[model samples]
Target chain A: MLVTVVGNYPKIPNLPRPARLRNAFARLDRGQITPEELAKVEDEVTIEVLKEQADAGVELLTDGQVRWFDEQTYIAGKLGGVEINGLIRFFDTNTYYREPIINGPVAWREPILIRDYAFARDNASRPVKPVLTGPYTLARLCRNDHYSSFEDVAFGLAEALNAEAKALAAEDPPLIQFNEPAITRHPEDARLAESIWRRLLSGLSGETAVSFYFGPPGDAVAAALNAGFTTVGVDTTIPGVLDAIAAGPKPPKLAAGIMDSRTTRLEDVDVLAGHVEAAAALAGSDNLYVNPNIGLEFLPREQAQAKLVRLVEGVNKARGGAK
Target chain B: MSKGLLTTSVGSFGKPPYLAKARSDHAAGRISAEDLDKLTRQATQEIIDLQVELGLDILVHGEMERGDMVAYFAEHFPGMSIGGLVRSYGNRYYHKPVIHNELRWDGPYTVDMWKYAQSLTDRPVKGMLTGPYTMVDWAFEEYYPSRRDAVLAMARVVREETLALQDAGARYIQIDEPAASVRFDDIDLAAEAMGIVTEGVTAKTITHICYGDFAPVYDQLIRIPVDQFDLEMANSGYDLLDVMREKGFDKEVGLGVLDVHTHKVETVEEVVAGIKRALEFMPPERIYVDPDCGLKTRTWEESADKIRVMVEAVRRVKAEYAIE
Candidate 1:
C-alpha cells in the first residue's frame, strides 16, 4: 500500500499568519509585486510541501499544485474555448471558484500541466503523482453554452484533458490522478461520469487514478473502477462511503481517505490506522492506499505538511511496521 | 411582520481593499493594534453611511473587523481557539475553530461593536451572531462528549450574547445559521439546539440560512423557535419562496431578494420584480427584504449597488401597496 495526497498543498506557508498569501496575490495583480517574485516564492516554498510528504515517508507524492490560481480554474483556463463565467461556491466549504464556462469547442492550448508536474518530480525525493480535475468534474463545473448536449461537452473536455494527461505521462511520472469531487454531489450523473473518465484515461501512457471527495461516491466508485484504471480513492470519512467501497468490485489499488484534511484537528495515530485496517479488511485486500480524505489545500501549507506527517504515520501503523 | 417589509443587508458588507490590507498588515505585526482598530471603526462608519444613503430601513455594521464569522466569535469566546484555514467553498476559506473545553460567554463578544454601529445610525442595527449550531457544526470538536453536547453548550454561549445585546438596547438580533442546512442528518438536533438559545431571548430573533438547499429541512426549520427565516431566494429564482408559499410560513419571512455571491449588480427593475414575486406568495405585512447572503464575498461597489437597488425596489413595492 502507498500513501499520497489527492491534490493541492498550501501555496504559501503563512509568511506570518493566515491570509497573507491571498493579500500578496492581490498585490501581484495590482502590480505592486511582479509575477516573477511570486513564482520565486512559490518555487522556494514548494520544496517544503514536497519535502514534508517525503519526510513523512509517504510513498507517492504530489507537487502540492502551489502555482495554480485555484484547483480547476488554472488548468481549465489553459485550454481553448473555456472562459471564466463567475465565482461559484467550490463545495460546502467557504471557498469559491471562478466557474469555467465552455464558450466554444474545448481544446488544449498547450502543455499546461507538464511543467507543474515536472517541477514536483525534480524537487521531490519520492515519486510524485500529478493530480488533475477529472473531465466529468471540469465539464460539470463549466457552463455548456456552446455544446450540443451534456454528452458532447463532456466528451470535448475529456479529449482535451486526455491530451494533457498524455503530455504529463511523457514526463514518466508514476500515476496521474484525476479528482472528481463533483460526481458524488449528483448521483444521477454516475453513469456519465464513468464514461467521461473512461474517455479521458484511455490510451494514457502511465498509471491512472480517479477519486471523489467532499461527499460519498455512492455507486460511482464501482462504475469508475470498470474503466481499467489502476486506483480508486474513496473518502471513507464522508459516511456510508466505506460500506460502499466494501461492496465494490475492488480496483487494483484503493486510496482510502482514512484521515480528514478538511479540519485542523489532529487524528490519533492508532485510531486512524484502525480506519485503514478496517478499509483493507472490508475490501478483502491489502491494496488499500492511505492518505488524507481530501486535498490538503484546505489547511495552511505548513499545517497541511504536519497532517501529511500524521497521515504517513497512520499508514505505517497499519502496515505493522515503521516505514 | 410588525416592521412592515423593512429592507436591510444580511450583515457583513464587502471589505474595502484598504480595510483588507489593514487587517493583513495588522496580523503580520506591520501595523499597531490601535491603528487596525481605528481603521475598522472608520470602515464600519463608512458602511453605515452607505446603508443610510441607500435608504435601507435597517442597518448592519458590515462586520469590517471580522476575518471569518466563526473565527471572529471564537476568538472572543472562552474554550474556543481559531484553528488553521479550511476550505469552505471555491477560493473562499475560513479558519475552523477548535473547541476543547465547555463554552462560556467570557463577556460581550459583539456588544461594543453593535453599540458603536448603532450609535452611528438611527436605524435599528441587527446584532449578528454565528448561531450555536453553525459554530458547533463548523468547529472541530476536541472535548465535547457528543456533537449534541457541543451544540447545546454553544447555544448557552449564544444566548448569553443575545441577551447582552438585548440589554444593550438592541431590538433586533440575527443569529446567522448558514451551516444548518448542510448537515441534513442533524436537522432535528440543530432545531432542538436552536430552541435552547432562543428559549427566553427578548429581542426579535431571526436566523439566516443560505447557500444550501432548504427542501430537506424545511418542515423542521419551520418549527425552529425564531421570529423570522431570512432565506436565500434570488439565487434560486425565489423557488424557495414558492416552496414556503405551498407549505405556508407562519413566522415572519426575510426574503433575500438579491444575489450577494456575485459582483454583478442587479438593476432596480430586477430587484423590483423579485420583491413583487415574493409579495405575491407571502403576505406583504409579514415580509422583510434583504440580499441572498452576506455581502462579504462581493466587492464593496457591488454590495452598495445591490443594496441600493433592493432598497429602491422595496420603496416601489410599498408605494404600489400604499403603505405608510
Candidate 2:
C-alpha cells in the first residue's frame, strides 16, 4: 500500500497555434474536421504524450487526454442522449464544450467506447488507469435539458457510465479512475450522488480500482466503500479535506493530492514530501497515493514536466522511508 | 449628507437563518417571487445599515438575491447557456455559462436593487457590474466562432447595462473584471473589447483586476477609459507601485491595502504602510484604500475587521498628510 503516483496529465500542446484558430476549432459546430479526423488527431497527440509521460518515469500514465477536450466531455460523448454543445468561457480565456444535454430515456449508445481508449493507452505502457467522468458530476454540471429531474438523469448517466466502466474492465486495466470535480458543488445532491457511485461500482466487473479527483470526496466515499472499491482519491492540499476522508471508512487507499497544478510556483520536493508524510500519518503509509490535485492542463509544458519529475522523485523518497 | 470613504462590491454574503428560511420556503412552494423579492429587500436594508454602522463612505445592495456575480446576469440575459464545471479555489464549483446566441440585455439589470439601496441612504452607493472581459473570460463560449467575437458580444450586453445604471442615478459604478490579468497575453484585444462594453457610461467608472501579475497589464490598464483602477496590492505586497509611479497614472487609483481572500485581519499598521508606499507614487487625494477584491470570500467578521483596519489606515494617512 505504499504511496504510488497515479497517472493523469493535463493537455500540453507541442507547438503554438494562432489563438483565434484554436478557438475556432474548439467551437466549430460543423465543417472542418469530422469526428473520425478529430479522433485521428487525438490518437497522434496521445501517442506523443504517452512517450513524454513514460520518459518521465511515471508508473501509470494517461494519454494526456488528447482524445477529449476536457474530462467530462469525453465521458459525455459515450452517454446516450448527451449532445455536445457550444463552447463556454471558463476562468480567464479558457473554454470547454458543454457536455451533451441529456434528453429523455438515457441509455448506453450500444457498447460504450472504453475499449477503444483503453487500447490506445495500453499501446503506451502496462497498468494504465482508464479515466471516466463520474455519473454524479456529469448530471450535476450538465443542464437537465430533457430529463424530468436531476436524480432521474443521474441514475441514467450512472447506468450508461457503469456500462463503459465494465467494458474497460474487460480489457483488464489495473484501475479505472473517475474525475468527479463537480461533486463538491452540490452538497445537497450527496445522497443521489452516493447512489450513482454505488450503482456504478456495483455493476463494474473484475479487479478495476475506482478513484476520484479534483474536489472533496463527499458521500461518494461511503458509496465507493459500500460498493467495495479499493482506493478513494482526495485532494489533501485543500483545508479540512483529509479530515473528511479520515472520517470515512477505514483501510481504504488514499490518493493524496500533494502537488499544486493551478499556479506557476513549483512545489519544493521537501515540502511535497512533507505532505505525503502527513497523508501517510493520517491514512496509513500503506494506503496513500501521491498526486497533483487536478489536471496540469493549465500549466506550461516545462513547468508540467518539472512538476512531474519532482513528484516522482519525492514519491520514491517517501516510499523508501515507508519501507 | 457626509461624503464617505470609497468601497467596491464583492460577491457572496452570509445567508442568515431568516433569509435561508425564506429561500427554503420559496423552494418548497410556500412563497411567491414577490415574497422572495421582499425578503431580499429586507436583507439589503440590513446590509446597508451595517455599512452605515461601520461609517463607510460608499454602500452596495450586497447582491442578496443573486447566487453569484456572473450567474445572476446569465439568468436574466437571453442567449446564454451554462457549460463546463469550474472549481472556485477549494471544493466550491461554478458552472460557467456558454454564450449560444446573439446577446442582448432586455433592460435595467440591477437598477431596482441599486436604486433601492441608494434611496435608503444619503451616502453615495456604488453600482456593481461584472465587466465584459471577465464575463467572456469566465464563461464557456460555445456559440461564438471566436473568443474575440464572443467577448465583443458580451461587452455589448454589459455596455447596455452600464448605461442603464448611469441613467438610474448611479454616481459611481464598479465593473469588476478580475479576469483581466489572466488574459494578459492578449491585453490589446481585451482593452478593445472592454472599451466597446464600457462605451457611453458617463458615470464615474472603476475597473477592478486581481489574482495575477499586474506589471505586464499595468500600461494597458492605464489606457482603458475608466476613471479609476482598483487592484489587489496587499496580497502582492505593493510589488507593482513602482511601475504605477513610473507610468505616472493620473487617474484615481484604488489601492487594495487589505487582503480579502483570507480570514487573517491585516493590522492597521500594515494597511497604513501599504498606503504610504502607494502615496509616494501617487498623491493621497488620488489614492483610495480598499481590500484587494470582494470580501465575499472571507467570513463576515474578517471582512468587517479588514474594512475597519482599512478606514483606520486611511485616517492615519490623512492625518499624516494633514488633509481632512
Candidate 3:
C-alpha cells in the first residue's frame, strides 16, 4: 500500500523560518515587490513543502497549493467570466475561501494549475499528482449569477474544467484527482455530479480519482465508481463511509482516508495500522492507498508533517515490512 | 435620546500602532505583563473615547489583549492548548487551538475588561464572548466524545462567563457565533448550545453571524435563543432583510450598515439607504445600527472613518423619521 495526501498541505513553516511566503505576500501588497517576486517566493515555499513531504516518506506529493488563495477561487478566478469576491467559510471548517461570482458564461480561459503543477513536478523528489477542484463543487460553492440553476453551473464548469484536464493530461502524470466534497454534503446533486464527472473524465488518458471528504459521499460513491474512475477516495472518519465502501462495486483503486486531518491529537500507531488493515481487507493491499480523511491544511504545519509520518508508519505496519 | 436607531459597533476596534507593537514586544518577552496591560487599557480608552466622540449609543473595549477571538478564550479555558498557525483566509492566519482535555471555565474571562470599559462611559458596553458553537467549530476538539458534547460543555463555560458579566453590571452581552452559519446543518445544535449559554443570564443577548448564505437557516437563526441577531447585511447587500421581512423577525436586529472588510469607508448616504431599507420592514425601535462585523481587520483610521459614516447615517435617518 502507498501513502498519499488528499490535496493541500500547510504553507506556513513550523517555526523560526521567517514565514518568507507570508511576508512576501504582505510586501507584494505594499508594492515592495512585483508579481514575479511573489511567484519566486511561492516557488521556494513549494520546494520546502515538497521536501517536507518527501522526508516524511510520502510517496505522492502536491505543491502544497501554496499559490492558491483558496481552492474555489484559485481556478475560478483564472477562468473566464468569474470574479473572486469576499470570504466565506470553506465547508464546516474555520478556514475561509473567496467566493467565485459567476457573472457570465463559464469558459476555460487558460490552463490554471499547469505552471504550479510543473513547478512541483520539477522540484519534487517523489511523484507529484495534479489535483483539480471538480466542476460540481466549484459550481456548488460559487455565487451563481449567470446559470439558471446549480446543475447548470455544474454543467458549465464541467465543460470548462474538461479543457484544463486535457491540458494537464498532456503533462502525462500518473493520475489526476478531482476534489468534489460538495456531492457528499448535498447528495441530492449526485445525479448531476455523475454527469459532470463523466464529462470531465471523457478523454483524459491518465488515471483519475475523485476524493470526497467532510462526510460520507452517499449516492456519490456509486456515481463516481460508475463514471469509470480508476480510483474512488472515501473519508473513513465520516460515519457509514467505511460500510458504504464495503458494500461496493469497488473501484480498481481505493484511497482509504483513514486518518483525521482536522484534529491534532496524533493517532496511536497500532490503531492506525488496524485501520489500514481493515481498509486493505475491503480492497486488497495492492489496490489500497492510505491518506488523511481530508487535506492537511486544517492542521498546523508541524502536526501535518507528524501526521504524514504516522500515516507512513501505519502503512508499513499493515504491510508487515519496511518499504 | 431615542431608543430607536441605537448606534453601536459589533465589538472590536483596530489596535493602535503603538499598542500593536507593544503586544508583539510583550509576546517576545521584551515587555512586562503589567506594561502590556497598561498599553491595552490605553488603547481601550482611545476606542471608548472615539465611540463617545462619535455619539454612538453603545461601545466596545476594542479587544486589545486578544490575538484572535476564539484563541483568547482557549488560552483562558482549562483543558485546551493553543496550537499552531492555520490560514483563516487570504494573507491571514490564526493560531488554531486544540481541546486536549475536558473543557472548564476557571474564572471570568471578560468581566475585568467589560468593567474597565463601562467605567469609562455612561453608555453601555457589550460583554463579548466567542459563542459555544463557534468555540467548538473553530478549534480542533480532541476530548469530548462528540461535537454535541463538546459544544454543550463549552456552553456551560460561556454561561458562567455571561453570568459573571451580568453580575459585573453588563446590560448587553454579545456572544459571537460567526461559525454558526458556516455549519448550517448544525443550526439546531448551535441554538441548543446558545440556550445553555444564555439560560440564566438577565442581560440582553446578541449573536453575530457573518459570511454565510443564510436562506436555508434563516428560520432557525431567528430562533437561536438570543434577543437579537447582529448580522452582516451590508456586505451581502442586505439580502437578510428580505428573509427577516418574509419570516417576520420579532426580536431586535443589529443591522450592519457598513462593510468592515474593505479599507474604503462607506458614504453616509450609502449607510442611510441601508438603514432606511430595514426601517421599511422592521420598526426602528427594534433596530440597532452597526458595522457588518468587527473592525479588527481594518486600520484604526479606517475603523473610525467607517464608524463615523455609520453614526451619521443613523442620525440622519432618525432626524428624518422623527424616530425619537
Predicted model with the maximum TM-score:
3
Candidate 1: docking tier: acceptable
- Can you rank all candidates by lDDT, best first? 3, 1, 2
DockQ of each: 0.35, 0.05, 0.68
Candidate lDDT scores, in order, read 0.81, 0.69, 0.88
lDDT tens digits by residue: candidate 1, A1-323: 77777888776555365454565667787899998886776776677778877887777888777676667788898899988866665666656678898888899879988877788789888888888898888877788889889899889989999999888888888778899888888888888887887888889756788888878888788778777678888888766777777676867778889888866668889978888788777754457677898888777666677778887777678778423
Among these predictions, the greatest DockQ belongs to 3
Task: Specify the poorest-scoring 10-residue window by lDDT in model 3 chain A.
Answer: A314-323
Which 10 residues in a row give candidate 3 chain B its minimum summed lDDT?
B1-10
Of models 1 and 2, which has the larger lDDT? Answer: 1
lDDT of 2 at A214: 49
lDDT of 1: 0.81
Model 3: CA > 4 A from native: A16-18, A27-38, A145-152, A321-323, B1-3, B264-273
Chain B TM-score for candidate 2: 0.91
